[model samples]
Target chain A: MSQQLAVGIDIGGTNTKFGIVDRRGNILCDGRMLTNKHEDVNCFLDELHQHMSVLIEQVGGSENIKGIGVGAPNGNFYNGNIEYAPNLRWKGVVPLASLLEKKFSLPTVLTNDANAAALGELIYGAARGMKDFIVITLGTGVGSGIVANGQLIYGHDGFAGELGHIIVIPGGRLHPGTGAHGSLEAYASATGVTNTAIEFLSTRPEVPSLMREHSKEEINSKLIYEAAMKGDPLAMEVYEYTGQILGAALANFVMFSSPEAIVLFGGLTQAGDVIMKPVREHMEKNLLPIFRNKVKLLFSELKESDAAILGASALAWEMKD
Target chain B: MSQQLAVGIDIGGTNTKFGIVDRRGNILCDGRMLTNKHEDVNCFLDELHQHMSVLIEQVGGSENIKGIGVGAPNGNFYNGNIEYAPNLRWKGVVPLASLLEKKFSLPTVLTNDANAAALGELIYGAARGMKDFIVITLGTGVGSGIVANGQLIYGHDGFAGELGHIIVIPGGRLHPGTGAHGSLEAYASATGVTNTAIEFLSTRPEVPSLMREHSKEEINSKLIYEAAMKGDPLAMEVYEYTGQILGAALANFVMFSSPEAIVLFGGLTQAGDVIMKPVREHMEKNLLPIFRNKVKLLFSELKESDAAILGASALAWEMKD
Candidate 1:
């Protein structure tokens, strides 16, 4: 029998990653292209189709391809559409799954990127053997995918698991994407860390730190992490505060999901104890007595590139069955 | 064929309500008894067993009893135990379901009151015909039950859906049950409303109103509602503030569960728009742009007693299937 393959695509604000994955969750061939989200979406889809064709040819032929699975910013599994994703500069709902299916003449499934990552973790990564857990991605923003009773929780409208937008600080700082004040995304994301560092620098200008060496335009979570490793007080404060907010949010999530473990993925999570320590502290402090010490928090074991593609492939694999 | 029946039992702080229901979600007969929580738990169980025996004999005898379902505080569905329920003064985990089964030689199931309530709503109440919704009970304390993907989201240990403990106000106030500071339960429960009213009265002693008549005794949420209905400004502020907190928490819930509707039950919810209006306004204001106007917030249509019994009965019906 010929080896069957599925095309997994992960769309982001700046780039789109596509891969041909097999039943074993291995990527056979992969490629990337600029999203250029500001342009017309039809043009973007056309570009994606061309790239996919080239990848298919490289991997042998379309005959091996069984289906397509996509993970995008505002993708909806039930509607098979991307509905006004802010990061993509898309307006209104676009029938993404149908368009892909029409182009490839194959089965296609779509879901929000966070849910895709969760499926990735479930099939090939940290949660491969776990039945219930929450996967949290802490990149430019905080996102989550929930698994309950061995299935992804896509509530009535297939738009569940927006953990980042939950309130962490009432009437505090404003979150970027949510247009809401005091959201968990405002305090826990990588961008949130930068904003916090800036605020901290503004308030405590007298403290000498490595952050002063970097230009304002170059200030990012990486530089802050480096400084914190060198014992920078302001950098340390940023991580502690960010972790506390994350921990508090996780405590609340425990109340709702009650997962055995909460898996952390994405860039900010790579900061290690600088972020995890405070999050655990606050979570333990805030959790109900019954739930305390019962939930575990862990870092994602999947590579970022493989995680997204694997997640999309998992969706395809699930659909195939 | 013998008619399929489900037994529902709701254990409250003051009373235990029991009912027999059919598969079509119709109640055949219902009864209630005062819960002597202050006495030994074994004695209480004996009394409960006797009452149930009498009712079962009067109705259709043991052969007609399909199954038994009990809803109580701190109940664990997975273990069929009631674990350290504060309201009931239970010292340790009690295998209530097993005990009931042994006594009656019938299949028995158990879950927390909140979870039962959510199941009730799904099977017979306002959320009938809906697969995704959250049921919240705003009584002496706030309790929540979550439904996702047409099933209760009992986490790894069967202890999920503790919505009231989610922190809505960090560093704001301490919660009585969890001892967590600034939890939604601290601001949204009936006790929370009374506490807010007391605080408001302390701040503005000059505002003479109907609340002055209750100066001799402790003020309950009922008195506050009555005062607000009589156009008292302080009482109105208390409701508005409580609703705002409730609304903010609900917004967070929307992000997580994405339920089609949130059904409010219990005594405080009876305040109607006095609580609902502010909750709706704050929820709308805080919702992400994509989720705005997509979810519904409504009061429970089932009578309090009926809901309690229906929820408990639904557990048995669900288990039998």
Candidate 2:
């Protein structure tokens, strides 16, 4: 009998990417659609159904698809739902997997985006042969997936690996989403870096730099990295401070998961060594003497566009058994 | 054929505890001997061997023992060795498992003390039915054992779960053993609390306290707990502050492990709600909204005297298969 295919869907705040993949981690066909999170969730599901219909027609109808796997913010593997996801303004529990299964008439699974990303990295990217490692995505918010002994830790309620929200500072700046102070997300996310940079600029107005060239609306992590690369002292400071916090957070992560390596992904990580250097330094300084030089920290080898699709696909692939 | 029993050993700074345990987590026999870490390791092993011989003789000899499992300071499961453990003056990697195996002709396994405690808890204590949880022992130093997906995470070299070393404060006070500043051990250990209390007392000499009744040399955690119970404001402050730091640290652990519960064991934890109340409050305050109230922090029910022995015996029981 011929092997069946699985559909992988990654629903982000801005876009929805989907792919038909096989058990071998091969993507056969893929497509994307704009995500209108502002609309009612039913409307979002309707839109998803339309996209699925088109993809089914494109791939010689739905009979070849064996199942569907979804990766979304606040997606719960245990419940097959998304619960009050911050990015999509999802309120309460949305029965996403059930809805998808009903629409497509296939076995379905759903999990938080970070877990999917870690699965992607494990099945097809830098962590291919590794059983233990943490995949951290530094984007709008810091997200993490922890794999220990080759399995994702979903905890009791499927709400594990919320690395971004861990307090990096006791009474430092407040995180917008959680209103908690000193969270890694409050310091390491794109918005986090912006907040830190804004605070730094406010305190050191004398350190004139390219950050002043852009309107507050135009300022983002990319421009900050570019400005720092151009030797802007203020920009350098921003990256340095951000890296320090990231490193400290990673150090704490090391204590718990003890992954062989930490793979970093997303927009902010592109600052490269500007961010990695400080992280490594702080991590080494904080590590127990035995583990000081044992662990490695690396940038994610997976591309952003491919990562979500691959991760989603990997989730489907992992469910084959 | 009758099922065989396994031997479990826990080596600490002062003593070595060992027991013969069955697969069902029942201890058949137990023994203890001085660690004598200052002497040649071979001599220490010889002493351990003698104790084991007596136990085996009582149990109808070595053939009935299937394996030996050891939990020690700096014990490494991956390499089956103990390396540069601060508690032991031993300077090199001691092939502990192999040495015991060679001596007694039994299969042997090894892991750090904290991991052993976690495995023990998983098999016989608070986390017996749970697949994921963190077991933290607050004694001379803070140590943790992480259980994710029903397995202990030894990390790259069995050096994982160094919860005591994670830096709580950036450039904070110096730690006694590592000399690193701001480490959890510097502020949360018994020695740490005493130091902090001393610092607090010197600044407020006029404050009448029960601690004044004991000589500085005799002042310990038990005395501090007694004073706090008598409404000593300084003692209360010390515990509150320690719990706050502990709670903050646990908040970080929750993000990484996503464990259902964090079980606290050992001397410092004896303070019960005096430590747990502040820990819960600070943890809730620091946690992200989604994670708030999701994780439970509880004290260990295992008696301190029995813990190390039980944990080590549990390791033997777990490895019997």
Candidate 2 error regions (>4 Å): A1-4, A22-39, A206-208, B1-5, B22-39, B46-64, B102-106, B204-207, B318-321
Q: What interface RMSD does candidate 2 have?
A: 1.5
Query: DockQ (C-alpha) of model 2?
Result: 0.64
True contacts kept of each: 0.89, 0.68
Which CAPRI level is candidate 1? medium
lDDT of 2 at A296: 77
lDDT of each: 0.84, 0.80
Clashing residue pairs for model 1: none
The most accurate candidate by lDDT is: 1
Q: Estimated TM-score per prediction?
A: 0.94, 0.92
Span of 10 residues, lowest total lDDT, candidate 2 chain B = B312-321
**DockQ of each two-chain model:** 0.79, 0.64
